[model samples]
Target: MGTRKTKAPPPAALGRAGTEKDLPDHFKNYRHVWVFIELERGEVHPVSFELLGEGRRLADQLGVQLAGVVLGPPGDSTRRAVAEAFAYDADLVYLVEKPLLTDYRNESFTKALTDLVNTYKPEILLLGATTLGRDLAGSVATTLLTGLTADCTGLDVDADGSLAATRPTFGGSLLCTIYTLNCRPQMATVRPRVMRMPQRSNKPIGRVIRHDLRMLEDEIVTKVVGFLSDGQSENANLAYADVVVAGGLGLGAADNLQLLKNLAQTIGGDYGCSRPLVQKGWMAADRQIGQTGKTIRPKLYIAAGISGAVQHRVGVEGADLIVAINTDPNAPIFDFANIGVVADAVSFLPALTEVFIRRLAPGNHIRLVN
Candidate 1:
């Protein structure tokens, strides 16, 4: 079940021209929307593609160019990232290559990106809010002395061509939109899965603005010691699941979580809980779903006994469908839920799990024809 948007985003001047009365004139010439295309060891993180999808929209709204910025070592790794960027809707790619950038170092990356922004100014810059992205964005923003909004869930352009970065605030108590009114190259960071991935096309890359990184390996303070990969774990994957079943305080007891688990396992989905569940020791921190936890955009979400607070709402707002089951018809979850069931989850969850088990039994496969 997918939840509907119960409330629209807060409005403001909605345009830079309206809000930039006192803005410095020196920052006015910046143009184009740029997304940092992250590449490591010949692989590109999916979040970069997601940001390209979002950046494309802002670029269209502003009637400006959408470019992907790639900082990596020269070779197949960097070239692949640039090619994929074009396929994901980037009009052009900004390629800055150097041996020192072969691995992600806060100092080298920060210097390289900041130099690029200063040299060929862009109006807006976007980066994925991952480990490497967060570190690099912070350093670059600090160096450029521009305003930066982090962990943004939404991005848009206003009438006067400003980056409107929307993210949850006050510990996810509410949503807020922030703008860099007087700053050049407004910056923002978005977590993985927060934005939808764009469809890939055969459209070839138009142009590549190649730049040189003025740095030496010895100047970099931190060094990559070794490369180690963690074994695959379920907790790390709750955000990307196609289906998710989550329990909340409405369950009344920890044992009740089994009902949600049963339903998820039967459907080959993942199970999670609200923030309170983690505080109460009913679930692990990794299993919590919300702004402070993992942001999910599953195809279908089943929230049982969850109150659907603003914080939790921001995380799941991207789900294709949301089904809420709770006894309180007046709960906030009901306002946004696509399908609301008024019943005690403690009793109803078990019954629903039983029904699904029977219907999905082996040899009873459901099929659809296009």
Candidate 2:
């Protein structure tokens, strides 16, 4: 038998220089970087701040201003979102407040954001890959007739000043970088927890460019009948958890998941699985962790029986500590994990659980026999 060799993907082509001589006359006027501050039900999504942190880096690289675009009804929530944007290091903010914009309607938000982009002409635009952000980004990009990359995991500026957006492709087997060479505003959407949150400060509010939305309420087709919220108890909230324990196919049987849950319960953490377990119908989709699922930044991550492919690695690389346990010493998980153990996860998990129970149980202490 012969081992199969995989072909490597070709390198991405470089984009044109960002100089005035290289860009089209119309695109030449585009300047600065803008991140849409997604506000829903009177609260700003944390993904907005994450994008701002990334936008700040791109802006510094391009030597341009970093701005936040806020569109919502005039209220305390809107005002607070603007202030928070400034605190997150936005050089300025573009405000569009109207009663019609109270609830996010695709028609209203698309009009407001497209109008802002047309008027101010930013060179780069970023949005969170949330439900609201996805709807608005698609509509705005379509209306503006520009290229838009969805669910990007990595974003950067090329030497030629093009927006380099990297995302998983071919069912998360490979990553490819995309560029909008001729587009005026290079647009991309990033999922929550994919980028690190920026440090915020109590800086005074900076320059705000207010723009009035001209569209009337009756002109919009979509109406908000009422708001229905999901059950809070059912929510996974996996991305924000302090500690996480995950398992993969090497666990051998679906029944073994209880080991993962037991460990997670012992540590006061959350438990999840890789994409395969979800595909196998052994785990819920929300419990899947990978490029196509939740991206986490937990303080500690324990991956048992996982091979640690690039897709899985990208999702948990933000963890402060990673401990991998697998029977195969050559498992890819060992390459990046902070600690690696070569052992059968089925047997190791129960022993690890017992050790924790002995050490962490209240008023339980064992004398050492040195």
Candidate 3:
């Protein structure tokens, strides 16, 4: 909620500030990478483990350990989630079991994670870019007075053993790599499926370090009355779908989204729309696909009439293969898409639908590309 503060480089040309405080020597001892494992309504968010998978890579690159920080109610589910983290490749897991953290409120989780970080320092902290994660990450980074990068598309270890956080800038037109130079626990949030989920090891070996929540429930400001799920709707599950058929602004009319649906149904895939479709009320919010929308990593993605701007690019970059249908060859979508068809989406969608329908008819199996 507050503006992220970056430390101004001290006047190195001159002398250090007279009031400059010295950092403790123990600060140098801080090591390893950490992920803030997010749990909502007794379910461990998938993004949390996805981050652990990535954190494991960074930790291995830096030759350090990867730890997951989970804060929630004291129960078997919470413990089970910690063990799952280890199975997913976390070298260590820090658990802050407390009643105040039963539900995801900004204040309680922030306090718990910050306390753990301060007690046992880590060089890097990663979180998911979900609504709850963004809310919690911003507050936690602010509380620790550290640098926080949101919605990073990539994370890597720099030569100096620091986190190289790469994210889209200027509304996703370009990419920028940010560093927390003098800050500890450089924080970042990766959207769901932005990183691959590591294979769960059958060995399942890791240490669980339990921490205490010093703050009482009475001291917390926010309270959770109930948990409302995004389900109970007929919208297709695009995020987890094997195939997704999405239309963009190029679809021309609100009714044109039906063509996308027809193609989706032909292939037994989910149907979705670009941001404009959602804005025009042609589709629901859950069906929108872009940076501000759901991040999808389907096995196959069909983008019709989408210009493929950076905002939309970041959201779908994880797809195994992308097929673009647009009249313009110069469309940015062509750059990243595996297959391109320079045809009007309105005209081509139906043709493709018919082709796929005939191909999947009974025992017919054929591959067609355009």
Q: Find the candidate with the highest TM-score and give its number.
A: 3
TM-score of 1: 0.85
Writing each residue's lDDT as its tens digit, candidate 1 over 11-63 gives: 54445435557557787788999999988767898899999999999999888
For model 1, the run of ten residues with the poorest summed lDDT:
1-10
The runs of at least 3 residues in candidate 3 whose Cα sits more than 4 Å from the true structure, single-residue gaps closed, are: 1-26, 232-237, 366-370
Global lDDT scores for all candidate models: 0.87, 0.89, 0.83
RMSD (CA, Å), each prediction: 5.2, 4.8, 4.0
For candidate 3, the TM-score is 0.88
Order candidates by lDDT, high to low. Answer: 2, 1, 3
- Stretches off by above 4 angstroms in model 2 are 1-21, 171-173, 226-228, 362-370
Ranking by TM-score: 3, 2, 1
Worst 10 residues of 2 by lDDT: 11-20
| Candidate 2 per-residue C-alpha lDDT over 1-370 given as tens digits, one digit per residue, 9 for 90 to 100 | 2321223543323213223246678998899999999999999999999999999999999999999999999999999999999999999999999999999999999999999999999999999998899899989998998989888889988888889998877546777787777777999999889899889988779999999889998899989999877567656889878899999998989999999999998988999999999999999998888887888899999999999987898789889999999999999999999999999999999999888888777765444222
lDDT value, residue 112 of candidate 3: 88
Q: Which portions of model 1 show Cα errors greater than 4 Å?
A: 1-19, 22-25, 40-42, 226-230, 252-258, 344-347, 362-370
